[model samples]
Target: MAASRTIEDIINSDTDNEGDFEGFSSESDISVCSDLSDNDSESESEVDQPRNDEWTKRFTPITVNDFTCESGTKLPDSFDVNSASPLDYFWLLFSMELFVEIARNTNRYAKWRMDQTGTVDPYWTETTPNEIRAFIGMEIIMGINQLPDTMMYWSKNPLIGNAGIQDIMTANRYQKVRQYFHVSDREKEPARGHRDYDRLYKVRPILDHVTVSFLLNYNVGRELAVDEAMIRYSGKLSFRQYMPAKPIKRGIKVWMACDSNSSYLSRFQVYLGRSAVGVEHGLGFNVVSGLTNNIHGTYRHVYFDNFFTSIPLLEHLYENGLYGCGTVRVNRRGFPTELKKPKEIKNRGESMVMQKGDSNLIATVWKDKRLVHHLSTLNQPDDIQPAQRRVGPTVLQLQQPASVKSYNKYMGGVDQHDQLRMNYTVGRNSKKWWRYLFWFLVNCSIVNAFIMYKETSKRPRNKKRYTHIDFRIELAQGLISGYTGRKRKASEIDCIPLVDSQNVSGHINGKLSGPKGRCRYHLKTLGVRRETVYGCTVCRVHLCRDGCHARFHNL
Candidate 1:
């Protein structure tokens, strides 16, 4: 008998050993029986070995009495969107209390800006809920109708431009809001000496609130998956990630758990370097364990890529009453030594299975174009399904194990979320690193809102639903129209009413007497002057009282 070799050895080794069948052999074929102790009969030196082998000592799989999918066998294709509208979804996530807090923060920051810039009036007036709502709407609209150049381009470009946007909320106002956007007061933050203080500080309360809101509002499917997303950013940051494979290779990495069926994001954790708080095990285990903490003691099944899968991690998930399946790297320790034995796979669809201890934990090594290994607690080795494979531009049907098929079907949930998010991404180039996170939350909120809208809409399936752009436009219009102040118009003139001056002095003896001035709106130059007794504070023009004041705002 020969010693069993690890999967890594077989994959990396350049052995020319060939199969006996037509040029192939079934040496790798191992039965996936309920027990492994019986297979040790093939190893004649069993008596000479120690009493406790690595396999017997490790992998104490707990026998689960019952297994069931929470949402039934067939997952829902779409949710029931009842009478809810986008605004309802928005309000649910960002509640009225949140709006009031945002208003307070905006006003505080506005006062700070006024004091710093020595401006007579603050850049933004005390913002009301309506105005803040409008601001967010404008942001969503801007995402759909993005301009190439700086935000100033929105005012200058005629075809896709709207001067009203700049008038209602000036570029200066936008800058001020972004500059002093605060979810938590600076004075109340935890001490910097804390382990997670950096990320806690970087991710302000608004983001944390929204993320929590998202998770709490939605129910995840029985099959959930964990993966990472790169929130695109080019700024210098402490925890920036650079994955060459990612399209946005340089940015912040966020580990997320989402529903495999609906692709709804359930929970997330941002990677904040080695000092990130509550980190346990490796990054992989920490991410999986943290994200799935809420789902523990349930029958939920988790799927992840090879990057995060390990024997210990799977065993721990089993201990927590959750089942998991993923591709495992051969080099990972605790994998059954007998299963890793070097043997030839005779054909493309050929497979070998091995189980360890008394638990249902099993590993199936399937031979295809390449050797593929899958580990699962829920799927059995004999559980095979039909899957299509591409062979030299021809599609062929092949038998695949249930674990492999399940992993493939559910593993892309995070990627699906990423795809939907990128379709109308609200992200833009920014100097501030926090802006990236802000836009990520904004995008996430909108996507979640969209999902809720779809799920709750009572409209027929064939009926045309609101597109992303349409939804954003509606929100923008709602916010803009809700503004309470007198709207500025092109027909208005910036001239002080002569009657106002006379009224102020109580000298209105049916005579107007004051310095000569002209309507600023009528003339481009200040050289022209007309007889006037009243003045406007902002425009600094002299004109009749009621007519000009009302005309300037209402026209």
Candidate 2:
């Protein structure tokens, strides 16, 4: 017999296009065609033209084999079934127990779903019950073995395919599992007085909600990512009046502090409202406090952004045995000095030092006994130099292009003329540079926080501070939220893409080419340094090392 063709082969065959049976027509068919053609040219045209109308076809004969078993095969013996492993027995017992629990307490919501779908009875009998039991059993096994859900299927029988195992571990399946695990009202309560029963059965709404949701989602003990998203919802009810009433729908603002690697360090959710009445109650602090209160070890550093970097807040963190580093708003009082207007502090040909005191700016130190509390250490002891006390603010300013250029020149580069031009441009455009500088500082702080968190711990925290403006900009740029801008200095013009170079390099010549001026790391003019690599993908411009990639990228 000829070899049977597979499905793929049959689909690939093109018998219609081959037009192979040229002389295989019957005499009657030929006569009928000739008669139709002779009758009318129009009829022949209509017959020859493709049918534009829809048509349907049906198949009747079976062309494929439908064998179930081979004649030589035999069923396994009872002894083989009895030889199952201990793990198998444990899984079966665990699953069955869970199934029983789910059957007992499946939620009213589950019932509602069943009712809406109009397949509750069939689902319950055919799949739901078994699935619930299986999931619970699997969960217990996972917990006892200290394994992640990702690895739970490893111990399953070979018959359970990857997809099948995944289906058994889904959120819905776990919900069913939860129903099984809940105790009956009668069991929860006792045949006793109301007060006594109430005392014994006190409900913990917050803890219960978190626990149940976490378990159902199979994230019981897992550390969540820092960049959790939030969407806004509103209601006209008096209770929700404080929320954004105009837009009606808004996005939640989240302030998150993460390490350098973008790992979640800490986060909080702040609702959108004109007043802090129903919001800004330190949701982040509460969560972090809870987490830290229950844990034993001390955190070395706690990162934060400008909004949360209040003196009192920092002091509180310090009291709790944690160090903090964050951007400080320029308006924030108590710095050693403040410059009212932007002026060159240092000049080669200047007569007298143009101090802020001599200029319009005035510096004052308020000794409010109520507010003069230290955050980490007692102001680094008075012996520390004044410059050191101003390091944070200086670092903040140096994050700008002009300051960067000055530093580069002070460091002495061989190409002095080009550096001078870059410096002059940055100095002349100080106002524009300052605007970018503010954003740059913000970005650098976030990036620094991300790096710190990633390098520090396994369970990073998140933030809760969102502005609609930030979100819209991020969306337009296709960037993740909380990104800061570039970290490069102004003197590093060589890092910028040379548009002229792009025009010169037409198409590829098949052979590898050297790095062109357009390349991100083109360091010839800028003088390649370790800091040039600290740029965000979007900016693709060399940045000062002080800037954070996460902040820059997002911005």
Instruction: Estimate the TM-score of every prediction.
Output: 0.71, 0.27
Q: Write the per-residue lDDT of candidate 1 for residues 317-389, one digit (tens) a residue.
A: 8877688999988877777654564376657776776555445577777777887887888876567789787
The reply for model 2, stretches above 4 Å from the true place, is 1-299, 331-555
* Model 2, span 1-555: residue lDDT tens: 111233234323431233221321112211224455466865774555423121111111111112121111111243132333222222211223433433444443355556666865432322355443354334333322342344435333444324333434443434343432322232445454555553212122211222222112110011111222222223222112222443324333323322222232222222323444553434444433433331111323343333444444444544543434343344544322222222433321111111121111112111111111111211111111211114345432111112112222221211222222122111011222121222222222222222222232233224354332222222222211122212332224333432321221231111111122232233433445343333332334433333232233333
Residues forming the 10-long window of minimal summed lDDT in candidate 2: 351-360
Cα error, candidate 2, residue 288 (Å)? 5.7
* Global Cα RMSD, each model: 13.2, 42.9
As for model 1, its CA RMSD to the true structure in angstroms is 13.2
